[model samples]
Target chain A: MANPSNNYYDLYRHGSLGVALTDALDELIGQERIDPQLAMKVLTQFDRVIAETLQEKVKARLTFKGSLDTYRFCDEVWTFLIRNVTFKLDNGGQMVNADKVKIVSCSSKKNEEK
Target chain B: MSNTTVGPVYDTIIAEVINAVRVDFEENGVDDGALEDLKKEWQHKLSQMKVAQFPWDPKPEPQAPPAPAHAQPTAPPPTAPPTAATYTQSTLSPQSAQQTLSLPGGLLPNANPMGIKPEPGFVQAEPAIKQEPGMQPIHPGYNPANGARPTAAQRAALALESQYGQRAAASINAIHSGMQINPAAQPQQVPRPGQAPQQHMNPQQQYRQGVAASMQQRMQQVPGARPPNGLPAAQLDGLNDATDTASGPGAVHPIMMDRAQIDEHLHAQIAARAKQMEGGGLMLPLKEATKNRSLPEKPRKADGPSQLDGLDDDVKSEEDDEDAINSDLDDPDEGGDDDEDDDETMGHMMLCMYDKVQRVKNKWKCILKDGVLTVNGKEYVFHKATGEYEW
Candidate 1:
C-alpha cells in the first residue's frame, strides 16, 4: 500500500486549503500589508502549530471511548478500528452491533472546539 | 498534513487574530457596531481569497489583472513556486534575503516563471446552476416539463385494457341488451299436459308422439267390433274420444291385473287337478306341491356308485327291523332255565364283545349287566360270544 503520509502531503499541496492559503498570502504581499519574508516565516510556523493541534484533537476524539491498537491518517481523514459499537440501520428502526468497526473521522480542531 | 486539515488550522489562527484585534479596538474605545462591520468585511475578504488562484513564485513579468469572480481556484497558476521553494526551505534558516538572491536549481522543472495564462481546455467547466454551500446540485438529465409517470396500479390497468378491451366491452353490452349468445344451449325439461305450450320438444318426446300417431292410425283402419246390446256406433266413438283426451298425447292406457281374482282362479284349477290324481280321497296341499316342485330329485346314473340307493334301502330296513326287535325284547316269558344259564354267562361274553366293538369303532359308551350291554336307549346281548347281534 502507498504511504498515507505521502497521500496527505499531496492533498495538502493541491487541495482547496493550500490554494486558499497561498492566494491570501500573495494578496497580502501585493498590498504590502506585511513584509513578505516575515509573513512567510509566520505562515510556516502557523502551519506547524495547526498540524500539531489537529493531531492532538483527533487523537483525543478517537480514544474517547477506549484506546485503539492502530489508527491511520490519510487523504484528509483519520481511519481506525473500534469494537462492539451500536449503529442504527436505515432499513428498519433496528440497532445492531458493529464488531471490528471501521470509523472514518474528518473532524478538524476548529469543529471540535466549536 | 491534508488540505482539509489546513482549513481548520487557518480558522484557528484567524480566530486568534480576531480576538487580538477586538482587544485592541476595545482599548482604543472603538464602537461595538464598528467591530461587527469589520468582522463582516473580514469574512468577505476570506471568501474572495478562497476564490483566487495561488502564485507561489514571484513572476519576472508584471502580473495580469485578477480573474473574474465566477472563476474557481482548482488549477494552480503557471507562476506557482518550485517544489524546493514551496516546501524544502529549512525552518532553521531565517535569512530570507540571501535565500531569495541565490535561486535554487534542479527544482520543479515544469515551473513557469513568466505567469502564463492556462489553456482553455485546462480550465474546468462550470455547471449551469451554481450551488450554494452545503447544497448538492440536482441531476442534469431531470426535466420539469414531463409530468409524473403513472403509478404501478394504473399502468397494470392500462396494460390489461390494451390486451382485452374490445372483447370485454362487447360482453358487457350483450348483457345490457338482454341477448343470449346461444338460445338452445339450456337444459331440456319435461312438459306437463296443462302447462303453456312449449317452443321446443326434445328427441325423446318427439319419438313417443310419432309412435302414438301410428298406433292411432292402425286402430282406425281396423274394423270396429259389433256393438254390444245394440249400442249405437256414435256412443262407442265418443267413449274412445274420451279415453284419448283423458290420457293426452303420447300417453298409453294402463292395464291393471286384479291379483285376488287371478289367485282364486288358480286355486280352483289346482284343486281339480289334485282331485283327479287322488280320486277325491286326499288332496296334497298347494304348499306341499310347491315344495316338491322346488326340490326335484337329481336322477342317479346307472353306472356310477349306488351308494345313495343303498343308503335309502338301509334306512327303510333299519326302521322296520327296529320296531320288531323292540317288541320281542319286551316279552319276559319267552325263554326257560336254559335262557337263565345263558343269561349269566352272556353278561361276561357281552362285556368282552362290547370291548371288541368299542375297539373297532373307537367309541366306548356301553355298560354290561344281566347279560345285556346298554348303549344310548338300546341294549345288546352276546348270543354265543360272536360279534353278531340278535336284538
Candidate 2:
C-alpha cells in the first residue's frame, strides 16, 4: 500500500472530506509519495480534528464517532461548530488553489477518525 | 205569499221535463252516433237563416263589432238573428230527443234570459272546449285511446312547456349578456315530495367569501407591500420614525426595542442567513450607527489610500487586540529550523494539528492546525507558536 500501483488505482474509491484534507497535509509533509489508502486514512484523521474542535467551541457534548462514516453530536449546538471553522489546508494560500474542506454534521458533534 | 202561487206550478213542470229526458236517454242509449246526428241537424238549421249576401262574404258568419287597428282585422260576414223558438226547436227536435245534452247560455240564447248569440256554426254543443291533437297518427306504436302516457320526447316537450323552461333560458341569456345576476334573485323550484331540496352553503360560507374578498381588496390597494418588489425597510425607517414622532409619545419607538422585539429582529437575521444559504435575494436595512459615527482620525482620505483612511477607530482597536493575543501565544525560539529536530517536531505538529482539526471537524473539515492542539476530546499539552510565512 506504501507504493502506488495500477491495481490500487483500479480498486474502488470512496473519497470524503477527511481524505481530501489528509491528501493535502501529506502532500505538504510526506517526502515519499503515499498510497491512496494511507492518504485517505490521514485525511479522515484530520477531519476528526476539525469536528472535535467545533465540539469544544459550540459546547457540544460528543456522543459517538465511528469508522464507516458516522458521527453524532449534542442537540442544537452545531451552528457554532460550522461558522468559525474552515476546510482549507492552508488559510494563507491562493484562494483558487487551496484545498477544500467539508463539514458533514453540526448538531451531532461526533468526529470521525481513521 | 203571492210568489208561492206561481212557483209550485213551475217546479212541477221542470221536474217532469228532467225525468222524461233522463228516461228517454237511458232507454235509447244515446251514444256518439246520436250526438253527431244532433250536431248535424243544428248546423243545417243554422244554414237556413237568410243572411245578407255581401259580395265579399265567403259564408254567413255571426255579426261582431269592428276591431281595434292593432288587432288582426278579420271582417265578419252578415247573418240574420235566429228567433228563440227556432233555436230551441232545432235542439229539441224528436230525432235528437233521446240525446242527453245541455248547451250553455253563452252559446245559445234560447237556453238563457241573457241574449247570447249562438256560435256561428253550433247550436247545442258546449262552447268552452279545448282541442288537443289525439296521438299523432304518423307516430306508429302510439296508443291513440290513452291520453296520459307520453313518449320520452313528448314528456321532455311537455316539461319545456312549463314556466320553468322559459326562466332557465332567460337566465342563460342573461349570463351570455355579461350581466351579473344577483344570486338571491333567482327563482327556486320546490322539489317533489321525498326528494331533497337543492344543497346550499349557509351564512358561514358567505362570511368566508366576504373575508376573502376584503383581503384581496386590501392586497390590491397596497401595491408596494408585495415582496421582492417591496422597498427596503431601512430606507423606510427614517420616514417611519418621523411618522411615529408626529404620531405622539405613545407611539412605539423607532430604534429602542425589548427582548421580544430583538427576537423579531434576530428572526429576520436568521431568515436572511438561510436565504443567503439558498442563494436567494436579500435586502438588509442600512446601519444608522455607521452613518452617524465620524471617520477615523488616523489619516484623511487624501493623505492615504481610501481603504486605510476609511477604517473606523473601533475596527483598528479590535485588530490591535488580536495582534496582542497572537504575540502572547507565540513561543520564543520557534524560528529554529534544526532539520532532524524539525522533522520529529513536524511529525508531532502534524499529529497535533490533526487532533485540533478533528475537534472542529463538525464546523470546518479538510483542515489542519499546527499550534496548540486537541486530541481524543482532550486538550493536549502544546507549545504555542506563531510566525508569518509566505506559501
Candidate 3:
C-alpha cells in the first residue's frame, strides 16, 4: 500500500512478470552485485515501466464471463473471486476456461494523479 | 497467438527498468556489467515461469514447450484423480442412508452440500446447528447435563461398530471417552451384538440409546472444537455434575452452560468422533479439495446452473456471498485458503487496477483496465475488461 518511488502501486509484484523480476533482483542483491537500495530503485522503475508498457504498447483486448463468487472493496482496492470463468481474447477469440480466478485490482487513477 | 507479443512488451519493460536504474547503480559505485547481468537475470526469471515466449529464447524451441504447458492447465480436474470422487460418494451415500432411518434434521446440512457451499462451509455449519437449542429454550433438558452422551453420537457408534466390525475400533473409543463426562445416568451398554437392524430402532428408542458420535463425524463436522491442550482438565466453569464427572473419561460436566459454551463442548465432542472417521485430507489434490469442498452437491462444474432449480436458493446464496465479502475482504478464495502450501505454478489469478468498482446491493459491476490476467496456464493483457456479477 505504501508507494516507495515513482508513486506507483506495487500490486503487480504478485503477477508472474513482477514475481520473476523480483526474484532476479533478489539474486543480484544476494550476490552483492547490486546493493538493496539500487534493487529497490530498479523495482520502483519497474513498477512505473510495466504499467506504462501495458497501457501504451499492448493493444490487445479481452472479455470474460463468470459468476461473481465474492467481491470486496476496501483501501481503494477491489478483490473479486470469479467462478466458472471463461475468458475470450479478441485477437483471435481464443477461449480459456478456469474453475475460479481471483482478481486483485487497485484503483487505476491513484498512480496517474502523481 | 497474442502471447507472442508478451515477450517484446515485457522485454521493453525490463530494458527500460534496467536502463532507468543504471544511474543509481553507478552513483552507488557499481559497474556497468552488473547492470547488464541484472537485465539478463530478470529475463532469466521471466523465462523460468515459462508463461509466454520471450524475445531472447531461440525461435525454434519456444513454440514447442509452451503449447504443452498451456494444454495441461486447460484440463485440471482430470488431474485431481478419481479418488476425490469416491471420497465424496462414500461420505454422501452413507449419511443419506442414515437419513432414511429417521435421523431427521441432523444430516440436513449434508443433504444439500451445494446449498451449504453457498455459505461459508465449516464456519456456517457449526453456528446453524448450535442455534437449535436457543430456538427451544427448554433444550437443557435434552442436553446430557449429567454427562450422558448425546443419542446422535450413540447411534453413530452403533453404526460404525456394525458396519466395519474391528476396523472402526479407534472412532468407537473416542465416542466412549466422550460418554465418561456424564456422572448422573447409569452408563448404558452399547446395543448388544444381537441388536436388531437400525431400521427397527424407532426415534424414541434411538434417543434412549444416546446415539451421537456418527452424525457429526460426517453429518456436520464441528470445527474449532478441539479441547485446549487435548485434556479433560477440570471444567473451567465449576459445575456440580462435573465435580465427580472428571473421573469419567469423556464425561461432560453438568452445569449452567450458555449456548456458546454448549456449542464449544458439543464441537469438542463431535470433533473427537470425526477425527477417527476421516483421516487428514492431506492426500487430496488442491483442485480436488477446492472443487469438492467448495461445491460438494453440485458435483460437476459443467452442470452447476442446470442443477440448482430453486430461485430461493440463488437469493440466499447471494446473501451469503455478501456476508463473506464484508467480513473478509483480504481472502478472495477463503474456502481453499487451507491449500495455500501448494506451489503457485499455475494459479488462476488476475492482477490489475480497477478504474471503478460499483455495486448496487448484491449486484456488482467493475471496469478493470491495463490488466495482466492469467487463467489456465496462459497470460493475457487487456487495455480494459468489464465484469458483472451478483455478489
Candidate 4:
C-alpha cells in the first residue's frame, strides 16, 4: 500500500529526523504561548526543510557495527522496507542480525575492497 | 524435626499463628485487655518453647528478658528477623544470599530453594520506601535548599508581567495625573437671577444674528436714515408728503390733487364720453335698422301668456292648450292602429290575463281525483278540449 502525504511533524512524531520537535510544539501549545495556527506554520516550515534535505544527494561515509538484517525508510516522499542486503564493515567482517541500523549516506560508487 | 532445626521455625510459626489469631480476635471485637493477656500468654509460650528447643543459647541471655514489646499487637515476632536477614542479604549479595537461604533451617524449602531469608522488616518499611528498582525516590528540582525552577503558572505570570506590567503602571499614572489636573482647568459656574439666562445658540442662529446686525448698521448709515419702521421707503415717501401741508398745489405733492389737474381730467372725460356717444349713436341705429328689416315679427300666441299675469282665464287657456298639444303628441296610437294593437296586446296580456290566471290558480286550494280538480269543497273537472277547469 502506498503511504499518504504527511507533514514533518507527523513523520517526526513517529521518531523521524531523530528529534521530538512535535513534543516541543505540544508544550508550547499547552502553555498557551503559541496558538495552533502558529504551531502549524512552524510545522509547515519544518516539513519544507525536511523535504528539501531529503531531496539533496549528499556524500556521507558511515561505519555501521551491527547485525541488522532488515530496515525500513518512511516519509512523505518514500516508504519501503529493505531486507536481506550484504553490508561491508570497516573492521573486515559483515553482520546480518542487527535490530536497528542507521543509514549513513548514499552514493553511486561500487563497494571498494579493502 | 531436630530441636536445633525446629527452634527458630517453631518460634516463627508460633509467632505467626499468635499474630493471626490476635488479628482474628481483634477483628471479631475482642477488647484491648483480653488481647493484651492473649499476647502475654503467647509470648511466654514462645519463649519457653525457644528455651526448651535450644538449651545452648548462641548469645548470652538475660535471666528473664521482659517480653519483647509488640509495636503492633497483631504483628508477628518473625518480622524483626526478616530485617536482619535483609541486612545480611544486602551484604552477601545475590549469590551468597541464595547460599544462606539454601541452609537447612529455611522455612520455605522449594519456594526459596536458594534459602534466602524473607525480609519481614521490609514489609513494615515498604510504604516509606519501596524496594523495587522502578520505585526509586523522585528528587523534585523544587527543593527550597537547592532553589526551585518556576512552575508553569508562575512562568506565565512572569511573562505577562514582562509584557504588560510597565504599560499598566504608566496608564495608571496617566489616569492619576489627569484626575489631578482636571479640576483646576474647569471653571465653577454660579447662576444669577434677573439676568436672562444665556441660552446656547447654534451656528445657524449666530449667522442669522450677524446678518441682522450688519443690515441694521447699513440702514443707520444711510443718508436719510429712517426709523426702523414697518413701512417701505416708497410708502413712507407718500405718507410724508400727505402729512406735509407746506407742499402747495403747484408743488405737485403725491397725495394732493391740483384744481387745473381736475379741470383737465374733467375735459378729457367729457371728450371720451362725446366720442363714445358719437360711435354708439351711428353704429347702434344702423344695427337696429338692419335687425328690424331682416327679422319677421313672432306671433304673440307662440310666446305664450306670462305666468305673472293675474288674469286666470288667460293662464288657464294657455295651460289647457299645452295639455291638449302634449296629449296629442304623446298618443303613440296616432302613428298606426297595427302598432297600437301590438303594443297593447304584448304589454298588457302578460300583466293582466297571465297575472290574473296565476292569481286564480294560486287561490285555488285543490286536489285532483281521477280527472276532477277538487278546490275547497268544490270539485271541478279539467276539460282538455277547452283547456280550462270546468265545474
Winner by DockQ: 3
Q: lDDT scores for all predictions?
A: 0.29, 0.25, 0.55, 0.28
lDDT of 2 by residue, B1-391 (tens): 0111112222232233223333333444434343233223322322222112222234544454466543211111112111111222223332221111222321111122111122223232212110111111111111111111122432232233222433333342333223212222211111111111111212111111112222222223332243322223322321232233223332133223344445543443454455455443223223422221222222232234553233333345434434444554444424332223333322111122222223433332322222222221112211222211111
Put the candidates in TM-score order, highest first: 3, 4, 1, 2
Taking the tens digit of each residue's C-alpha lDDT, what string does model 1 give over B56-137? Answer: 2133322445776432233223232111111111111223212222334201111222001111121221110011111110
lDDT of 3 by residue, B1-391 (tens): 3577777888898888887887888999999989888778878777777778888987754443444443222122332321222222223333432443443433221232322222222342334434332111111112122223444554455456444534664675466446434423423222222222331333222221221211122123333343323312211211222223323433343333234344543443453344334343335576444322323222222234643233334334434544544456646565566245123423888888888777898777788888998766667788888877675
Better of 1 and 4 by lDDT: 1
Q: Comparing candidate 1 with candidate 2, which one achieves the higher lDDT?
A: 1
Model 4: per-residue lDDT, tens digit, B1-391? 0113323432343344344344444554545454344334444443432333332344553356676766432232442321222222233233332333334532111222112122322233232222221111011011110011123332232233233543333443333233323222211111111111110111111111211222222222332243333223422332232223123321224223345434434443453455455653455466453332221111122234652232233334434444444466556544565344333322111000000111152132112111111112111111110111111
> iRMS of every model, one decimal?
61.0, 50.4, 2.1, 61.5
**Once superposed on the true structure, which residue ranges of model 1 sit more than 4 Å away at CA?**
A1-15, A59-114, B1-10, B16-391
Residue A16 lDDT, candidate 1, scale 0-100? 31
Each model's total of backbone clashes? 0, 27, 18, 7
lDDT of 4 by residue, A4-112 (tens): 2232223322221112345555555676654566445445444433323322321111122222222222331211111222222223343222222222111111111
lDDT of 2 by residue, A1-114 (tens): 112222111100111222223334344335433334433433333333333332332221111111212122344221111111111112222111111111222212122321
Give the TM-score, chain B only, in order for the candidates: 0.13, 0.11, 0.31, 0.13
Can you list the residue pairs that collide in candidate 4? A67-A97, A67-A98, A68-A98, B101-B115, B101-B116, B102-B114, B102-B115
